[model samples]
Target: MPQIFRIVPYSIYFWSNESDPLEPIHVHISEGRATSNATKIWITSTGKTVIKVLGENPG
Candidate 1:
């Protein structure tokens, strides 16, 4: 199961991490049960906040 970080009532964030390696500091956002790619992200502050669109990987 994946963990979810709530940013607000309408938006949620999740960190991107893999088993072997992880992606550059990035976050996944969603409106609800929908896909994260549908959500847009914005970065605020230096090396502090990062917002971006969430996407699914093909296996």
Candidate 2:
């Protein structure tokens, strides 16, 4: 995964595998590099972000 940005306790990124033609544009958020516990947010064609999954620590 390549990190897009970071803000304190959270890191925003996207996996390189996302380049697959079947995948939509989206982002993954996690505490540090624990991607197994990350949350997924899908960027809709309408330019909105929809939470696809909640992280282990939703706080």
Candidate 3:
């Protein structure tokens, strides 16, 4: 996972596995490296972060 940046308690990142292709630009937000409990956000071309899905323990 490549970390893009961090904001307070949330650490944003994305996986670099080429085996599974991820369409469109998106990011995973989680506290620490707990990706399973993170939220998924889709990035729009207009520079907007849209919430795609909320994790089981989303903050």
Candidate 4:
């Protein structure tokens, strides 16, 4: 399950596919792609993004 929001310019914000639809999993946000240097965030059930795991380290 992916949740996308309409945001402003230069903001590549979009929820990619979930790791598993059946499982909520750890509720932690991770990089959608292992090889991707992209940033990810943990989201609530209400589709609100939490600032829990922002692994935006310089590559």
Best by lDDT: 2
Pairs that clash in candidate 2: none
**Clash pairs of candidate 4?**
none
Runs of candidate 4 with Cα error greater than 4 angstroms are 1-9, 15-35, 46-48, 52-59
lDDT by residue (tens digit), candidate 4, 1-59: 23243243213344346455542322332333232334455556887765543455332
Model 1 backbone overlap count? 0
Best by TM-score: 2
lDDT of 1 by residue, 1-59 (tens): 14356544444454445335644544445555535354445445575665444465221
Q: Report lDDT (Cα) of residue 6, candidate 3.
A: 87
lDDT string for model 2 (1-59, tens) is 67899987888988776544756877888876646557888898999888866547454
Candidate 3 off by > 4 Å: 18-21
Compared with the true structure, all predictions reach lDDT values of: 0.47, 0.75, 0.73, 0.40
lDDT of 4: 0.40
lDDT of 2: 0.75
Where does candidate 1 stray beyond 4 Å? 11-22, 34-46, 53-59
lDDT score, candidate 3, position 5: 94
